[model samples]
Target chain A: MEKIVVVGLGLIGGSLALDLKKRGDFKVYGIDQNPTHVKKAIELGVIDAEISFSELSEADIVIIAVPVNIIPKLTQKVLDVVSNETLVFDVGSVKNEICKAVENHSKRKNFVAAHPLAGTEFSGPEAAILNLFDDKVNIICEADKTDWRILDKAISIFKKLNMRIKMMNPIEHDRHIAYVSHLSHVSSFMLGKTVLEIEKNEEAIFDMASTGFASTVRLAKSSANTWTPIFLENKDNIINSLNEYIKNLKEFKDLIENNNEEGLKESMNNTNYIKSILNGLK
Target chain B: MEKIVVVGLGLIGGSLALDLKKRGDFKVYGIDQNPTHVKKAIELGVIDAEISFSELSEADIVIIAVPVNIIPKLTQKVLDVVSNETLVFDVGSVKNEICKAVENHSKRKNFVAAHPLAGTEFSGPEAAILNLFDDKVNIICEADKTDWRILDKAISIFKKLNMRIKMMNPIEHDRHIAYVSHLSHVSSFMLGKTVLEIEKNEEAIFDMASTGFASTVRLAKSSANTWTPIFLENKDNIINSLNEYIKNLKEFKDLIENNNEEGLKESMNNTNYIKSILNGLK
Candidate 1:
C-alpha cells in the first residue's frame, strides 16, 4: 500500500487521515508536535500509526495541516526531506506567503499550495470528523507552479475526498479569502467579545441568545492557536477587510441612531440578495 | 374551540398559528395588512382563515406579531377591540416601548409584554415552519403588570408550543437582547455589506464563502421590513452594543496590525468562553 503521511494531527489533518484510511487503500500515518494528539489520533483510529520527519522520503504523499504562520517553513522542511516523486501540500487558510516561500526552491514543482475550505469551531484530534471535506471547495493556489504529474496526483486525491477543485493565483486567493473567511472570524470573535463584555449576567445570554445569535457568533468559538497565526500572516488583506467592515458598521450605527428607516431598509434590502447567494451555496 | 387571532402573518406569527392549529384546539385566524401574506397563510394552512382588525373583539386570544415600530400602536388598538376576558399579547423584540405604551391603558392588564426569542432570517408567511418555537426561550417582560388570569392563559399557550419561559423586566429584556439578538443582526448585516462592497466579484464570493461565512452572515438576509423598526426602536441599547462591538473590532485590528500574536490569542481565548456558553444553550 502507498504511504500517506499527515503532519499536524488536528481537526483538518486527523479528519483527512480518517477519511483516507476509510478508503482502505493507503497506510495513513500522523505526526504531531503534541504527543497527546498523536496518541489520541492513534487511539481514535484517525491514523494507522505515527511517523517521523526522517521517514518522509519513503512516503508517497505528505500533507501539512499546521497553523498558517508555521506552514511556510514547515512546507520547506517537508519538501527538503521528501523524495522528488513524492507529492506534498499544505492545507492552510492563507496561501500567498507559503507559495512565495517555495517559489525558488529546487523541488518547488513537487509542492502544491492548497486550502480546503472546511472546518468547525472545535479543534484537536478528537474534533476530527468523517467526510469533513466532502463536496467542499479545495482551492489550489499557484497551480501553474506545480508539476503537472504531481498536481494531477493531488487533484485525484481531492477528487477521492469529493472536493470540488478551484484554481486561483495565490494573491487572488488571499484577497478573496480575507473577505469571505478571515473577516467573518474577526467579526464573530469581536461580536462574542462585545456581548460577553456587556452582558455581566451570563444567565441572560444563556436564556436570551436565539439561534441567530448562536449562528452569527459560532465562529467565535474557533481555536485561537489556529486563527491567530492566520490573521497575522494574512494581516494586510485582513486589515483592509476589517477597515471596510468597521466602516460599514459605523454607517449602520448612524442609520439606527438617526432612525433612518428608509436608509436602513435600503441597505438591508440590498444585502438580502445574499439570500439568493446563500441558497446557491446550498 | 378557542379563537386565536394572530396579527401580522409573517414567520413568527404564522408559525405560531400553524403549531396552535396542529393541536386541533384553537381555530387560528391571521390578520396582515399585506393581502399577499394573508392569502399565503391561508393557502399554507398556517391559519384557518383571515380575520379583520374589526373582528378582534370576538377573539378569545389575540397575538400582536407586527414589526417593533408598529407594535406599540397595534397593541393599543388590539386592546381597544378585544373583550375584557380575552387575553392579548404583543410579540415584538423591543419590550420597554410597547410595555410602556400600554402601561396606562384601561386594558393594560389584558396585554402581556412578550418577546418570543424565536424566528429565522427569512420573513413572510412562506417562511413559517412547524415547531419553530420548539424548546426556544419565550421572554415575558413586565409579567407583574399582566393580570393573573390573562398571564396564566398566555403561559399555558406558550407551554403548549414547547417554549421555555423566562421572566425579565422590559429594560433588562431590551438590554440583554441588544447584546444577544439585535447586535448580532447588526454585525452580520454590516459583515455582508462590507464583503459585498469590497469584493466586486460575486462569483469569487460564491466560491470562496465557507460555511463559517454563511453562518456569521446569515442574519444579514433577515427582512429589512421586519428589522428596520427593531433597530430604530431599540436604537439606544443597540447603539451601546454596536459601540462596544466596533471598539473590540478596532482593538482586534490594532492587534493584527502590530502582529500582536499573544494579544490576539488571549482575546480569542477569552472569547472562547462563548463555546461553553453556547454549549449550555444547546
Candidate 2:
C-alpha cells in the first residue's frame, strides 16, 4: 500500500485525504499545527493517522494544502525532506510565488504546483466531505517545470480524484483566478460589510433578506484565516481586479442616481451574457 | 370558485398564479402587455385564462404584479374597475410610491400593498414554478391603510401559500429592502460587468469560476426589464446603499494594497455573522 501524508488538515487538505483514501489502497496520514484539527481529522476519518514532518520521508506522497501565504516556504521545507520518489504538490489558490520560490531549487522538478477550483465557504476538518473535487477543474501551473515522471504521477492522482486537468503558467492562473474567484469573495464580503454597517435593525434585515440577497452574500461567510492570505499573496492581480470592480460599481451608482434607465438596462442586459457561460459550470 | 387575476405574467406573478391554483379551486387569470408572456403563461398552465383590465370587475382578487415604475398607475387603474368588495394588491419591489399613489383613493381600503420575498434569477412566465413562495416571507406594507377584511383575506391567502407575514410601513420596507435585496442585485450586476469587462477571455473565466463565484453573481442573471424600474423607483435608498457599498469596497482594496492582513481578516470575521442569519432561510 502507498503511504500519503497530508499537511495542514483544513477543508482542502482534509477533504483531499478523505477522497484519496476512498479512491485507492493508501494509508493517509494527517498533520496540522492546530492540535484540535489533527485530533478531529483522525476522529472524523479524514485521515487514517496523524503524522509528523520527521516521518515525511516514509510517505510515497506529500500533499501541502496550507494557506497561500505560508505555501512557498512550506513547499521548500517539504521538498527538502521528501525522497526523490515522493510526489509533492501544494493546493493553494495563488500559485505564482510558490512556483517562483522553487524555480532554482535542486528538487524543483519534484514539486507540482496545482490548485483545484473547489471549496465551500466552510473551513476546518469538520468541513471535509466526500467527492468535493469530483468533476472539478484542477489547474496545474508551470507543468513543464515539473519532471515528466512526477507530472505523470500527479496527473494520474488527479484523474483518480475525478478532476479535469488544465495546464497554464503561474502568472496566467493568478490573473484569471483573481477575476473569477478572489474578486467574488471580496465583492461579497464588502457587500456584507456595507449592509451590516447600515442596517442597525438586525431582525428586520434578516427577515427582508430574500433568496437573491442570500445567494449574493453567501461567500461573505467564508473563513477569514483561509482568505486573508489569498488576498495578500495575489495582491497585485486582486488589486487590479478590485479597481475594475470599484470603477464599475461607481459607474452603476451614477446611472441609478442620474435615473439613466436606458443605461442601467443596457448594462444589465450585457451582463446577462454570464447566465449562458455559468450554465455550463457545475 | 373565486376569480384571481394576476397582472404582468412574469416570474413572480406567474408563480403566484400557479401556486394559488394548486392550493385551491381558484380560477386564475393573467394579463400582460407582452402578448408572449400572456400566451406563455396560459400554455404553461400558470394561469387558466387571459383577461383584460375591463374584466377585473369580475375578479374577487386582483394582483398587480407589474414593474415598479408602472405599478402605481396600473394599481390605481385596477382599483377603478374593481367592485367595492374586490381585494386588490400590487407586489412590486418598491412600496412607498405605490402606497402614496393610492393613499387618498376612494378604494384605498380595498388594496393591500405587498412584496413577497421570493423569486428566482430567471424571469418570464416559463420561470414560474410551483411552491416558489413556500416557507418564504411576505412583507405587507401599510396594513393599517387596508380595510380589515381585505388585509385578513391577503393574510389568509399568504398562509395558504405557506408564507410568514410581516407588517411594515412603506418607508421602512423600501429602506430595509434597499440593503437586503436591491443592493445585492446591484453588487452582483456590477461584479459581473467588471469581470466581463476585464477578463475578455470568457472561456477562461467560465472554466475557473468556482461555486462561490456562481452564487455571488447569480442575481446578475436577473432580467433587465424587471430590475430597471425597481432601481429607478427606489433610487434614493438604492443610491444610498450603493455609496456605502462602494466605500466598503474601496476600503477593502486599500487594506489589500497596504498589506493590512489583520484588518482584512477582522472585516471578514464580522461579516461571518451573516451565516447564522442566512441559515434560517431556505
Query: Tens digit of lDDT per residue, candidate 2, span B94-116?
Result: 99999999999999999999999
What's the lDDT of the predicted structure labeled candidate 2? 0.91
Residue B28 shift from truth in candidate 2, angstroms = 0.7
Which sections of candidate 1 miss by over 4 Å? none
True contacts kept of each: 0.87, 0.86
Docking class of 1: high
Per-model DockQ against the true two-chain complex: 0.83, 0.82
TM-score of chain B of 2: 0.98
Q: Where is the poorest 10-residue window by lDDT in model 2 chain B?
A: B202-211
- Residues A1-282, candidate 2, lDDT per residue (tens digit)? 999999999989989999999998899999899999999999999999988899998888899999998999998988999899888999999999999999998899899999999999889999999999988899999988889998998999999999999998889999999999999999999988888889988877777777588778888989999999999999999999999988898898898888998999999999999988888764
Q: How well is each residue in A1-282 modelled by candidate 1, as lDDT tens digits?
A: 989999999999989999999864999999999999999999999999999999999999999999988999999998999999999999999999999899999999999999999999999999999989987999998888899999999998998899999998989999999999999999999999998998889877887777488888889999999999999999999999999998898999999888898999999999988877767665
Model 2, residue pairs in steric clash: none
Docking class of 2: high
